[model samples]
Target: MLGRPVSLIEADDASNVDTAIKAATKLVKDDRVDFLMGTFNGDVAIAVSEFAKQENRLFMVTGAHIMDLTGSRCNSHTFVFMPNARMMAQAVVPHIVKAYGNKWFMITADTVDGKAALQAMTEALKAQGGDVVGSVTTAFGATDFTAPLMEAKNAKPGAVILNLYGWDLVHALKAYTKLELAKEKIGVGGMIGGEQIGRPLGYANNAGVWGLIWDPKINTEGSKRFIQGVIDKYNHTPTSRCYHGYAAMMQVLEAVRRAGTTDTAAVIKALEGHEFDGLKEGRSYFRAWDHQHVQDVLVGEAYGKELGLGHYKILATVPGDAVAGGVEQNQCRL
Candidate 1:
């Protein structure tokens, strides 16, 4: 690694598409950064990618999982390092069906990404001979989920799949507890839930089958070392977003190193269809067809509280190639 200092430009005003584009444009016009990254918002991510292509700068999607990010909306300047909604549904639905039952009730976040995930999950269920018993859509930042939780409780489906993330997920879990849904022995699953919401509640409350994009405790030498290094540096455990950021940075660095220059085109060439080690998933690579990172999707169980932060007992390791859809499924032209 070079000793040269890497400058960081923070964009606190990235709440909307217009603001996100403006912040990125300012960085390229003023600081002249080699590339750009981030934006957890799906619409904002698409706007930023358009900026990247127009500016001839590479952009790595470190967060956000709108299927279109790597599907119809993908571009030459954008590469997605995180799994998308479709991948999440395919990886977790089978496990949910086997563990719980065929009937499901979905309480989904009201957003484009949320809608896409719901559709993908619905298709997965149909393919597996499972069925959706009932469903409800809620606003993105709604604080109270009592009404929906009560409705879902009465429906009495075999399980409830939360198509929620971030604060929405936390709110729904607390409401689920307060409403005494757990007393009925009904199970809860999530298409996009992780340690950010689970750790605070501990295993006893968060216990169940769930999908995870990454885990710091995966059994591998590289995984253990990477997890330890983060703890040593940050004095805390890593979240799924932390793992996503790390993997994206690592890929960028590797591309630059292999390309032997910071030129965007060369770096992009170096990354696509290239396999590499160091990820917790024994191996990983960016698909040339769509720029989606192909790696294992983990299904884990939290049976007890002592598993600790960033820890979960693996229920299954869904193969990356098997889960990452093929070219027929890929819509990206680039």
Candidate 2:
């Protein structure tokens, strides 16, 4: 392991993200935490990013998949470590397009995030020769799926792709099953539709769901050791959240060594053309033009009994550049 001094802290972003901002502001203003990391909710990440910019600390995000963290909201001091919304859509375009071309009805959450997920997926659908027949949007954690799933059931979509993630998606699955929205006639899939989201879906529900991931539970040369490091360090195997967070740290650490100073500008310059040493995608880097880090994507299906982990399934690597979210000038205003 490379010798470095890395201190870790968890901002109480989960309790109230505003509290995360106050904590981050204090670290940057008082303690001067060399680099600010985390508070993964995009809104929290954005707040901290602004603080980082004002204080000249580096705000490197681990896995707050919102597109704006890098898209419209990017700043000189704010950098994303993991893939974003556009990247997610890009990763799965080929599979969804090729496997189930045409007719999609999105059962998206009635929240900002759901809207973004729906947007990214719709863009992907259009790219692969499909049309959104209609969509049903519900609140972030709406308990009732009777209305939405029933609409989806009647729409008779060639596919019904959900945009929800984590626990919300789990309830949505239960509601879908309860509403008798589970359709064998129509192909169904969605982001976070695999092990993490699938585990609660159970064997019967997860059996047919598919998804895209950055890593899989398979034996590969570097992966074995890499995963072991995660397990040893965190007392558990790395979740996508954990792996991407580590990857982001690795990127910033590399930039620090290259720059020899945590001066925001210097590190920014160092990261511009740098190649990160990730375990799965051994050599990865961001394009200077858009700060889009190119890396591997995987296609997987839910299988066997889930160990109540973040995600569990056998995954196959897709072509690294499978989705192709355009990279040149970003939408970031600044």
Clash counts for the predictions, in order: 0, 4
Model 2 sits at a Cα RMSD from the real structure of 3.3
Instruction: Please give the range of 10 consecutive residues that has the lowest summed lDDT in model 2.
Output: 306-315
Cα lDDT of model 1 by residue, 271-320, tens digit: 99998763666468888888888888888875545465555677787878
Off by over 4 Å in 1: 1-3, 308-311
**lDDT (10s digit) by residue, model 2, range 1-334:** 1365677765567724679878987777777678887765566777778878888887777756677877787877777666566667766655665555578888887655677788888887787778998798777767666777777777877767878776777777677666554444555667545445654566566533454545546456666776888777778656566566767887888788888877778888888756665556434676565455666666655555644443545345554455435545368654
Candidate 1 structure, TM-score to reference: 0.95
lDDT of 2 at 130: 81
- TM-score versus the correct structure, for each prediction: 0.95, 0.85
Q: How many backbone clashes does candidate 1 have?
A: 0
The C-alpha stretches of model 2 lying farther than 4 A from their native spots are 1-5, 15-17, 97-101, 200-204, 207-211, 218-220, 233-235, 306-316, 319-329
Q: What is the lDDT of residue 129 in candidate 1?
A: 96
